[model samples]
Target: MAKASVNSPSGPASVETLTTRGRKTRDALLDAARTVFEDVGFPEARVELITAAAQVSYGTFYRYFESKEDVFRVLSDQLFEDIHHRGPSDSTLSPAQRLIAANRTYYQAYRRNARLMAIVEQVATFNDDFRRLRHDHRHQLIDRQARAIARWQQEGLVRQSLDPEMAARAMSAMVDHTLYLWLVQGDEANEALLLDTLDQMCLGALGLDQD
Candidate 1:
């Protein structure tokens, strides 16, 4: 029902056009669902509320998602996809450089989806469905980063003693906690504070000397 525009070309124009349209529809529905969920929470965010907000009918909603949990799963997966490309693609930048890029993307995504993050955090605490859904996505992201951290350690970009799994978990915790605090409390999620905090934690965990 709504159109989303793609300005910069990343691939063939025709394919990009199709992708832009599909992405827009999904994003619109997700955004609307998040808003309804934030206002009414997981238990009360009915399909009607979401469909109404998205200006779509119940049939349209089902065409895109089977259930509310399905949408929530999509939301978490989309968040991870937004953060990392999850491929062994080449990057001209070093590992640390790429990590910084990923961190920035994560924070920006958190800011943009603050309401949804809040809803997910609350639902995750007591709801097994939400918890399992969120946990699965998080585990995948952590594992991927762990592999990258292992590579960085082998290259001496990180300290030899830093356990990649532990480092990945710590990084995930930091991002989650930071976002939760900002979103739940309406506090300013300062970029500098986030960067400084993450940098310090990473440096300490990796046993790197203070720069």
Candidate 2:
């Protein structure tokens, strides 16, 4: 009941039309790609495997993704967007309370997506584009954290001498490294203790809770 067309050949006529079935088939390929990538890791995953998993013809994949990496790039973009959970929404929550909520949400999201996250790290190791992608993602967060710190400094919540960029990067590292170890690296540790420690460290770094 839907319309679709072949985009691989680069024809406007094809791009302008696709059937519902065509859309379904395209989605199947993407879904299958995710499964295959997660199972074998991106480096070893084959397009044939993805096609087989999707129950689609080999030619059908080409109609959509130009290559394995193309499909992977699409999947990676989606996953990275979801990697960080939203910040606090409760306007009444104290800054410390908001930090705790944000940290908790981040930890939970990371745990759920650990497998894909691990693959992202592996892919970034040798792939220049993915490496840059990872760096840019971090850089963005650093900027946000720096802005937040600057605001806190103005409110006299944190020391004025604290460098916003430096502090943000440091605290961001603290949370990222800790979770990467516990979730991605499968380090053995008490989950509650780990999260508690993260909360304490972040709060102290922000000069929220101190002696």
Q: Compute each candidate's TM-score over C-alphas.
A: 0.72, 0.87
lDDT for each residue of candidate 1 in 1-211, tens digit (9 for 90 to 100):
1112222333112324446666677668888987787788777878789989998766666655656777776776666566544435447865655666676667677777677677777878987877887788789889988998898778777877778999899878987786677666766867688677876676567654543
Name the weakest run of 10 consecutive residues (lDDT summed) in model 1. Answer: 1-10
Q: RMSD (Cα, Å) of candidate 2?
A: 5.0
Best by lDDT: 2
Model 1 regions more than 4 Å off: 1-31, 58-60, 85-90, 188-190, 208-211
Residue 8: error of model 1 in Å? 40
Where does candidate 2 clash, by residue pair? 2-19, 2-20, 3-18, 3-19, 4-17, 4-18, 4-19
Model 1 TM-score, all chains together: 0.72
lDDT of each: 0.70, 0.80
Scored by lDDT, model 1 comes in at 0.70
Q: Candidate 1: give the clashing pairs.
A: none
Candidate 2 lands at a TM-score of 0.87
Q: For this target, which candidate reaches the highest TM-score against the unseen true structure? A: 2
